[model samples]
Target: MSTGPGILAPVTALGAATLRLLGEMGAMFLFLADGLRLIFASPKQIPKILNQVFVIGSKSLFVILLIGVFTGMVLGLQGYYTLVKFGSEGLLGAAVALSLIRELGPVLTAIMVTGRAGSSMAAEIGVMRITDQIDALDVMDINPMAYLVSPRIAASLISFPLLTAVFDVVGILGGYVTGVTLLGINEGVYFYRIQTSVEMADITGGFMKSLLFAVIVATVSCYQGYFTHMRRDGVGPEGVSNSTTSAVVLSCVFVLVADYALTSFLL
Candidate 1:
């Protein structure tokens, strides 16, 4: 059978795309399974998970707080000026609260956490893979996935939302300070505006997005690290480095994409 180039190109492209998606889907399922297993396995792992969560979540609190403060301040400054031009400066609180709670809070926190902890996880695990520590776990009859991947995932699940909550509080406070102290708006007005304008849905949606971002960050980082085959001749350090870079890049991209999709569906 002879096939023209035009006849096979479309089929080949379709097949490649399908296979790529399937690979991604399979990896996602595996990541989910590993996370569930780790969550359900030993009770002793809970303390470890908490410790990791503290390291990942609590440790990042200062950064989140700083970012939230500046973000809210800048948002307030700009929003107040813009609203003033429209003779609606009173809506500054509503604008800052809504934007932070619905969009900036979770997304920015996710990006920061991914850069801080996600990259570290990938590099650490990638080095372990290169050193055959993962293989040694196989020899010892221990599940590498359970031992390494699960804890990070569980930690992320616990931490990301906590971080989001912190982001929410700090950001609101920042906006309040900027509005009342810096811009000469009434404190009661700013507080009351946000209190009434901010809906439960806004908080819940941000929390949900944070949770999803956590999972995506953990899974993408772990997958890249875990699947790195360092023994492939010239692809040792280079492969591991590439995996680390890919993990960070992919996690950031996935977080933004998921944020948009989730917002569309939920709100």
Candidate 2:
């Protein structure tokens, strides 16, 4: 007859698991619906979308450039040493180009964006949630999802590819400098090798991955922030903090997973 504790334990565990799964599913559906709406309602918000794209894409150029340069330099230095041991120093350009275009560019850019812009987006939305601004938008007959979330998703879609291209170009320049100037590789030979080695497939693969990463980052950040309960009786500062942390961690994990999946399928 004293089965109260055992029964209560299982019931509580099930209830908690159910609630967590429901919350995650709800957030995912909201994000999907938001993305679909943006895709269908495109022409109306072109200007706003463009503004966001510019802000998201252009504002990130400096950091991407810096990372690209360093990445290229390091690649060249490392590749050169490795190839020299095998008398294959001429493959330096191809090595750098392949590495940058295939892996490092997308992954590094995503990590940086997730850490910088993603965190910012989550924090900003968290603040709005806590302040009831999102609710006020609903009361004013404005679709908060359309107004707040769509622009970001659109901006990310447009910005990520551009950022990837920038990363590619800057990284190549970095490799060129280190290889030609420091390693004494002939400039013409280095450029020619890169031109021949890198193909459209590599470029396309990187861009596709970047686009997916952008979507993942934007969606995760928005979801975390939007679902964050800041009410007095619900999620408070601690919850918001957890949301922000989870957003970054989840975005990173998805980026890496997506990268591998895309690479496998594409290549």
Candidate 3:
């Protein structure tokens, strides 16, 4: 009889945890819905959206360039040695280009953007939440979702695919530099194989993936910030910290998971 109580305790805790998680997900869905509705409800937010685009896209360019260059270089270096072993070094450019266009470029762009911009977004929102800035908007009859979040969400949707495209281009160029110059592969052969094998399909599919990932990153970051609450576990500044950390970690996890699903479906 006593054992029954002990067994039920863990089960009860598990059920409660599951419910809490489901509830949070439902709230986030509603948050997204509200943002979507308001984006059209208020078309006058164009300037804000454009500003966010600059912030999300232009500000992240240097990091994207840095990441793209190093990643492509490494891929080229490793890929060359491997292809050389198989006596297929001429295919190196195709291999590197396909890999970047199909996978690494979009995924890495999401990660870098999430780490830099996404965390800042969460922290900003978290601070707003903690300071009752959101409540101030409510008092002014302003829809904060439209004013604050929708612009960012829309901007991210635009920014991520563009950034991924940049990453793809830069990474391919880096791969060419390493494979052709340092690796002593024929420059003409390298570009020819890449141009021949790489297609519009690969580029389009990868862009689609980045667009979906952008939604995940922006939504998760904003949701965490908008809903930050003081609690015993962590609240106030602690809550902000927790929310920022959660936003980044969850964004990364969701991006990787979505990448797998998108890859499976698209490829």
* Predicted model with the maximum TM-score: 3
* TM agreement with the true structure for every prediction: 0.92, 0.88, 0.96
List where candidate 1 sits over 4 angstroms from the true fold. 1-3, 230-234
Q: Which structure is stronger by lDDT: 1 or 3?
A: 3
RMSD to the hidden true structure, all candidates: 2.2, 3.3, 1.3
> Which 10 successive residues of model 2 have the least lDDT summed?
230-239
What value of lDDT does candidate 1 attain over all alpha carbons?
A: 0.87
The lDDT-based order of candidates, best leading, equals 3, 1, 2
- Residue lDDT tens for model 2, 1-267: 677787799889999999987887687767867665765574767787787777678888889999999999999999999999999899898999999999999999988878878887787788788779999999998777887788888888888888888898899899988998999988888888889999999988899899899988989888888878833334767667877887899999989998999988998
Task: List, residue by residue over 1-267, the lDDT tens digit for candidate 3.
Answer: 257777789899999999998997898889888876776776688889999999899999999999999999999999999999999999999999999999999999999999999998999999999999999999999988998899999999999999999999999899988999898999999999999999999999999999999989999999989888743458899999999999999999999999999999997
* Model 3: how far residue 199 lies from native, Å: 1.9
Query: After best superposition, candidate 1 residue 236: deviation in angstroms?
Result: 1.9
> Global lDDT of each model?
0.87, 0.85, 0.92
Worst 10 residues of 1 by lDDT: 227-236
Error of 1 at 44 (Å): 2.3
